[model samples]
Each structure stands twice: as structure tokens, then as C-alpha cells.
Target: MKRICAWCQTSLGEVSSNIHSEQAITHGICDICLNNLFADRDIDFIPFLNSLSAPVILIDDNNTYLSANSKALDVLAKDHQFLKQKRTGDVFTCENAHLEGGCGHTNRCGGCQMLQLINDTYEGKDSFDHVPVTLFQKHGDVRHKLDLELTTEKVNGLVLMRIDSHK
Candidate 1:
């Protein structure tokens, strides 16, 4: 049976050693890539995330919610609208997006490089380190360009995802 890694979708390699024996693992790090993948274990990364120019969110394993910074709340949340919805995908909508019908099902994010980065990590094919991506967003009448630097590492059993924007 050929199994795929959730982080990057890579074919599971020969199990030289089982990191999560019962759950399963790929290479040295699958879900336990960052030593720990939980919230409590990510306190140290707080300072690092806070310093980022772009917003950042530490998504929990359930893909529901975790933690975000002030800048993130401002750009990502946009006056509690997104937080009220409780889903990042909801808040970052592209319905009125001149390009595609919406963000989720558009060429903007559909063929997004970030998604590829995530796919690579989930498949255990890429390191998920310092991967650069460009995303499309509508800022008023202008379609702004956002350079996304995504790093998917584990923190206290959770995915400590850092998303920073660049010019």
C-alpha cells in the first residue's frame, strides 16, 4: 500500500525507524518536525513571529485556529470580521476578486506557490524551510502583490506557521 505524507504528499520512504510508530512518520520528521507541535511549546517563537513585518498565524493541527499577531489581525482579520468567522480561508476571501470568482477556486491561489510549498511539506518531499511565494490580494481598487515567506514547522504538536509579506 502506497501512503502519502500529509505535510508534503511524498511517498512514504522505507521506515528505517518509526518516529510515531502507531501514528506513522516520514523520514525523521512528519508531524513531529519541530520537536514539538503544540501551542504551549511555541512560546519562544512568539517573539520571532511578533517581529515579522507581515502577519503571522500558528495554525493548530485541526486547521481551525491557533495564534496570530497584531499585524496579522489587522491585515488578515480586518477589524474582527475574519476572527468572527474563525477561519483564515473565510477571512481571506476573493469573491469580489476581479480575476477569479473567489480566492479558493481561482488561479490566484489555485495555482499558488504557497500551496505547493505546503504540499511539499505534507508529502515529506521538501524541507518546508524559507520557501518563497507570491500571492494575489485586492487592496481597494488595486490588486496588490504580496510576497509570502512560509515556513511550516511543528511547535508543541501544532504547526507553527509563519507567513511574512515582502515588497
Candidate 2:
């Protein structure tokens, strides 16, 4: 199998394998590409995210939201101050998040597809598109069921999670 940089299509290296008859290609970002993509952080931070049409949120390994684009803010109905450093459940107003232990620590968290997708992408250093997710959101005294499709990409040290669609 061959590992290639997804952005520049540059070959990183090849992996020895005897399982497959045909050579397969795996995608990942190279160090140079990573640096180049994030070098101009000051100017490109918000603009880069804003350029994306989907509602995108940048999250760390701990599930802390680092940043969100305008689309994401509009969808989430929250500003940067409310999202920054907040956990996924808290940001989305998940009912389980308000319980003891909070967010990922709650018993119900185990079945959360969105959290699983984020963790899987981060751990595997892979990207996933159009993954179905169902979230139980709480607002005032009502609990609402949200069906959504999510796309996640591992960008450097952050996971770019996009709300592809919602219903």
C-alpha cells in the first residue's frame, strides 16, 4: 500500500503488504503540507474556515471547540465566546452533558455517534464524510431529537467537523 498526501498528492512512502493483489493508496497529510496549510495562522484562521460552505467547527483531541466558522455559529446559534473551549455536548446542549460526570464521561455518551466519529477520526488520523448522527438536544424544558450528517477531517492537530446536513 502507498501512503500519499491528500492535499498535494505527494507520495509519503509505501507500506509492504501481501494481502492485496493491487496496490492501494492511503491518504494523509505531510509535515510540510501541514506547516504550509497552517503557517499564516493570524490572517487565515477565520477566513479559511469561513471559506468552507458547510458549518465547520475546529475541535481538539479533548473535544474542546477551538473555533467555529460563521455558518457553524449560525447553525449552533452561538458566538465564539460561547463555543471556545467548550466540550461537544455542552456546545450542542446535549441532555447527557448536564448530568453528572458530564459529556464523554456520562453513560449515555457511549452511544453517541458524533462523539465516536470525532474520536475515531482523531485516533486513526483519517477523514470521514456524510456520517449519520443523532443527538438529543435540550432547550429550556424540552428535549429535541436532531438527526444530522457529519463530515470530519483530521487537519494537523485539530479535527475539522462539518455539519453536512441536519433535520
Candidate 3:
């Protein structure tokens, strides 16, 4: 089987396989493409993120917000400083994040589709697209339900989560 870079289509190499197949191809990102996609030393971090058209946020393996694009900051109604180091639930104002255990530590988090998606992406699972997510946010005394669709891709040890649609 041949392994090829999914982004640039560069041939990585061939793997030994006992089962014969006619030029089977496996997909993966090459080092050059990965660096180009996530790390461009010439470009500023915020600017690189802002270059994307969608509302995107970069999260670490632990699901902490490392940075967010301008569109995401606007959509979330928060600044970069406020979102940095915060978890998904906290950034989205999920009601459970305010509980004793907080965010991922809460019982509700186990059933949270958003958290599950993030975890799956961080663990090197295939990227997700247009996955539906529901969040219960507490605003003063009232709790409001927010519905969202998200797409996630893992790159350079971080997950880029894009908010596809929300209401």
C-alpha cells in the first residue's frame, strides 16, 4: 500500500502488505503540509487564524482554548484574553461549567456531544463535520438552550474547531 499526503498529495512511501492489492493508497498529512497549515513562522498567530473565513478556534489536547479567530470572538461575544485557557463549556457559557465540578468534570459533560467531538479529534480520530451540539447556558436566573453545528480538524497537536451554524 502507498501512503500519500492528503493535503499535498505527496508520496510518503510504501508499506509492506501481505495481501496483494493494485496500488492501494492510504491518506495522511505530510510534515511540510502540516507545518504549512498550522505553523508559518512569518505570519502572526492571530493573523493566521483570522485568515480563515469561518469562525474558528484552536484548542489544545486538554481542550483548552489557545486562540480564536476574529469571527469566533465576535460570534462568542468575547475577547481573546477571556477565551484563552478556557474550556469549551466555559467559553460557550454552558450551565454545567458553573457547577461544582465544572465543565468536563461534571456528569453532564459525559453526554456532551461537543466535548466528545473535541476528545475524539484530540485522540487522532477522523475529523468531524457538521456535528450537532446543544448547550444549556445560564444567563442570570434563566437558562437558555443553544443549538450549534461544528466541524473539527486536528493539526499540529491542536484541534481547529469551526462553528458551522448556531441559534
The best candidate by TM-score is 3
**What value does the lDDT take at residue 67 in candidate 3?**
85
The positional error of residue 162 in candidate 3, measured at the CA in angstroms, is 0.3
User: Which sections of candidate 3 miss by over 4 Å?
Assistant: 1-44
Q: Return the lDDT, model 3, position 109.
A: 78
Candidate 3 lDDT for residue 71 = 96
TM-score of each candidate structure, all chains considered together: 0.49, 0.75, 0.76
User: Which 10-residue window in model 1 sums to the lowest lDDT?
Assistant: 19-28
1-167 in candidate 3: lDDT tens per residue? 57766567777678434321231111244567657866633334576567567798888778688888999999999998888779888899899988777789987777888889998887877657788999888988899999998888776677878888989
User: Residue-wise lDDT of candidate 2 within 22-140, one digit each (tens)?
Assistant: 21111254557666766642334566577556688888889888788899999989998877778999878888988988889988888888789989988974547788989989898
Candidate 2 Cα outliers beyond 4 Å, as residue runs: 1-34, 37-44
Ranking by lDDT: 3, 2, 1
Score candidate 1 by TM-score against the native: 0.49
Writing each residue's lDDT as its tens digit, candidate 1 over 1-167 gives 44444444565566534333432112234554334423364354445455545566655443434566677666664643344424334445333334444433456555656545544554567446556876656667677666666666544455545554445
Q: Which residue pairs show collisions in model 3? A: none
In angstroms, give how far residue 70 of model 3 lies from its true place: 0.5
Candidate 2, poorest ten consecutive residues by summed lDDT: 18-27
Candidates, ranked, TM-score? 3, 2, 1
Candidate 3 residue 88 C-alpha distance from true site, Å = 0.9
* Predictions in order: lDDT: 0.50, 0.74, 0.75
